[model samples]
Target: MAAAFDIGLIVLLVGIGAWMIVVRDVVVATIIFVVFGLLMAIAWVRLSAVDVALTEAAIGSGITGTLLLGAAARLKGADAGGTRLSFPITVVAAVLCAMISASLAAVALLLTYPAPTLAPMAMQNLDQTGLGNPVAAVLFAYRALDTLLEKVVLLLALVGVWSLAPDRAWRGVPSLDTTVPPSDILAFFAQILPPFGIVFAIYMTWTGASNPGGAFQGGTVLAVMWLLVMMAGVMRAPSISNVWLRWLLVAGPALFLIVGFTGVFIADGFLAYPPAYAKALIVAVEAALAVSIAATLGLLAAGPPERMQQK
Candidate 1:
């Protein structure tokens, strides 16, 4: 039954992908895209990759889908329907895509019976880091540089988004569409859900060393909760120029960098935590990263500034 279910899911996903491509309506396509993400999350879980599943559900589907839906809403009727490529160009593009897919399939099929992996080695050193979850150990201990760079990339992406603002509204408040009145239920959920969300986020962060959850997953939850509150008019979005907000925006990556440089003078070098304090430092970094991630994602979703800041 489980095998059948997995097969069915794969079929459904393929159908959804096809529908999304053929559906001319941006809104409908975006909805399908979200469903695809959710299904992919389930797929990841079935594969025993809970950490990936959480990230996929939160970032890939939830936040990214929201961003796309908002873009669709803001761009509704703005698409003048740009010129389509010539038949030959379209054929060429399709052929190239097919060739790439075929190459990937070939590579997968030709893999060694027992594919090479570093899981055993990673697990062996997991204790040294005092992290129970191999995924967390790999991220913060095995390849800390990559993790730090990833957070920096997110901040840079947020900055790129902010740069789109006009000179007049450069440091102003992001403009959310307030013309439509929010439903009472939304406001109610905004109030109640956030407390649970906050607790869950904290749990996810704290237990990440021993479980599948981590900073990005928890941070995304906080980000989504903040957006919900803003949508319900429970709180005003912060201005781009807000001092406190700016500090939060850089706190995660900045702290990560500082730790890296400190490592240069101290232990093994560059993000190397001392044996006694490895878990403690990792937790601290995750905490700071979660805050910055939440703030950055929330502001990114709120879009570029549209009006002057309120006094």
Candidate 2:
């Protein structure tokens, strides 16, 4: 039964993905892309990668789809085509895609039956870090520096997004259509949904050390909730240059750096937590990271500021 499900899933993924590529309308293609991301998340789950599945569903499907829809709305009727692909170009593109797919499949087929991985060793050392989830142990302890850098990269990406704003709007709020009155359905959900969403995000972050949830997944949910509320006009978007906002944006990385440097003085080395305090420190880091990540993802999806800050 499982095998049959897996096979059907593979076919669906291929069919949906191909449809996305060939779809002419931008909004239609973007919607199909969201579906593709959801299917990819399911594929990851089938491979027993719950962590990857959560990330895929959250970022790949949710936030990315939001971004695309926003873009499509802003550029409505702007030269996006209904034209069919030229025969030769279409043939070439199809051939290239097929070759890439075949090569990837061949590589997978050629791998040893018992694939090489460091998972066993990672599990062996997980107890030292006192994390119950191997994925959490690997992310927050085994490769702490890499994890730290990942958050930093997210910050940088947000910076890139903000840089697109006009200089005069640098201190302004993202134009989340605050002036337009939200629909009844949207406003109703926006009013009631956030409290529940915030609690869920907290649970995801707190339970991460022992379960499949973590800062990234939690942050993504927070981001989605923020965007929803802003779009619904339930809450005004904050100024990009608000001091407190800036501080919240950098809070995670700053605390992470402080702890890492402290490790150089008191523990094994940079980013190292003493065995006795490993879990405690990791949770602290996770909490801080969730806040920063939430803010960053929210702003990124909101796009560059478009309205002047209200005095």
Candidate 3:
């Protein structure tokens, strides 16, 4: 029965994806894309990657879906007179997509005969970081530089988005639509949900050392809560020029860099923590990174500032 269910789900996913591609309406296609992401999350869960599943569900499906829906609304009727591809062009694109898919499948098949695994090495050194979760160790210790660079990239993306703002709105708040009033139900839920969300985010970050939770998952939750409050009009979005907000955005990466540099003098090299305080330092870095991740993700979703800050 389980096998049958999985097969059925895969069939549904393919069907929906085809529908998304064939459907000309942007709103419908965006909705289908959200469903696709949700199904992908389920697939991740079945693979025992709960952390990745959470991220897929939140950022992939939830936040992205919201952004696309907003865009679809604004772009309504803009595609009414858009040109359609010629039949030959459509066929050529289809053929190219099929060739790419076949190539990827062939590569996967070739790699499966002697499937590579990093579990052994990761497990062997997991204790060195004093982290019970091997995934956490890999992220914060074994591959710390990659993780740090990911955070830096997120900050840079935010900077790029801000740079796109017009001169008049450079320091203003970036929001989807300030004039769109929230429904009473949404406002009430926004007010009621943030406290619980905050606690959950903290729990995920703290317990990540031993569980299927981590900075990214926890930060995504925090971002979701902030977005809810802002969208619901419970609180105003912060201005781009707010000193405190800017600091919050950079604090995590700054701390991570400082900790990395400290490793050169105190331990072996960059991002190396002494054996005794490895877990403690990792936790501190996680806490700061979580804050920055949340703020950065929220601001990224908010896009460039459109309205001037009210004095």
Candidate 4:
């Protein structure tokens, strides 16, 4: 029965994904994509990867879907002039996609039984990191560089987005559509839910060392809350030129770099921590990174600022 349910879920995901591709309406396609993300999250949960499931639901489905939906709304009539692909070209693209998917499926089916894993190795070193969660240990100690580099990549992506802004609108405030009335349920929830959201974000960041929560998930919650407030017109979006805002955005990466280099002088090498201070340093970095990640994601979703600041 469990196997049957999993199979049904996979079929639903595939059908929705195909519909998203073939649907001409942007809004409908975007909604379908969001559904796909949610279904994927459920699959992750069933696989007992709750950390990944939270991230998939929050950043993958929530933030990304909201951003794409907003863009689709703004681009309502902008697709009228695009050139259509020829039948031959369309068929070629479809064939290429099918071949790629088939290759991946083949790889999955051919994998070795008992599934080689690093769980044991990770567990062995987990105690040294003073973190109860093996996943957190890997992220903050065993593979700290990989984690730091991921955050750097996010910052670079944000820079790339900002660079695309028109010169006239550079350093301006992001313009979000806030036409929703104050008495609407959206606005009411936005107002009432943020306090609880903030508490949840903090709790996730704090419990990450011992459980299936982490900076990314916590940061995503913070970002979603901020976006909600902005959407509800409870708070104005910060200008790109705001010094404090930029500092907050970079705080995590900056602190990570500082801690990384300090390790070289005091410990084994870059990103290494003394066994005694491992958990402390990791938590400090997570806290800072959570704030930075939240700010960065919020701005990224906001896209390049479009409205000039009023004098």
Question: lDDT per prediction?
Answer: 0.89, 0.90, 0.89, 0.91
lDDT of 1 at 66: 86
Best by TM-score: 1
Better of 3 and 4 by lDDT: 4
Query: In angstroms, how far off is 178's CA in candidate 2?
Result: 1.6
Candidate 2 structure quality by residue, lDDT tens digits, 1-311: 99999999999999998899888788999999999999999999999999999999999999889889988986785765547888999899989989999999999999997999998899899899999999999898888899999999989988898899988888898988775466667888998999999999999999999999999899889988998898888888999989999999999899989999999988989989899999999899899999999999999889999879777
- Residue pairs in collision within model 4: none
The true-structure Cα RMSD of candidate 3 reads 2.2
Better of 1 and 4 by TM-score: 1
Model 2 worst lDDT window (10 residues): 74-83
Instruction: For candidate 3, give the lDDT of residue 289.
Output: 95
List ranges where model 1 is wrong by over 4 Å: 178-183
* lDDT value, candidate 2, whole model: 0.90
* Alpha-carbon deviation at 125 in model 1, angstroms: 1.0
Candidate 1 per-residue lDDT over residues 81-161, each given as its tens digit? 568889999999999999999999999999997998999999888889998999999889899999999998998988888
Across residues 86-195, which tens digit of lDDT does each residue of candidate 4 receive? 99999999999999999999988988997789999999888899999898888999999999999999999889988978899998988876677888888899999999
Question: Pairing residues by index, what is the TM-score of model 4?
Answer: 0.94
Could you give candidate 3's per-residue lDDT for residues 200-290 as a string of tens digits? 9999999999998888889989999999888888788999999999999999999999999999999999999998999999999999999
Stretches of candidate 3 above 4 Å error?
A: 77-92, 176-183
TM-score of every prediction relative to native: 0.96, 0.92, 0.92, 0.94
User: What is residue 74's positional error in candidate 3, in angstroms?
Assistant: 4.2
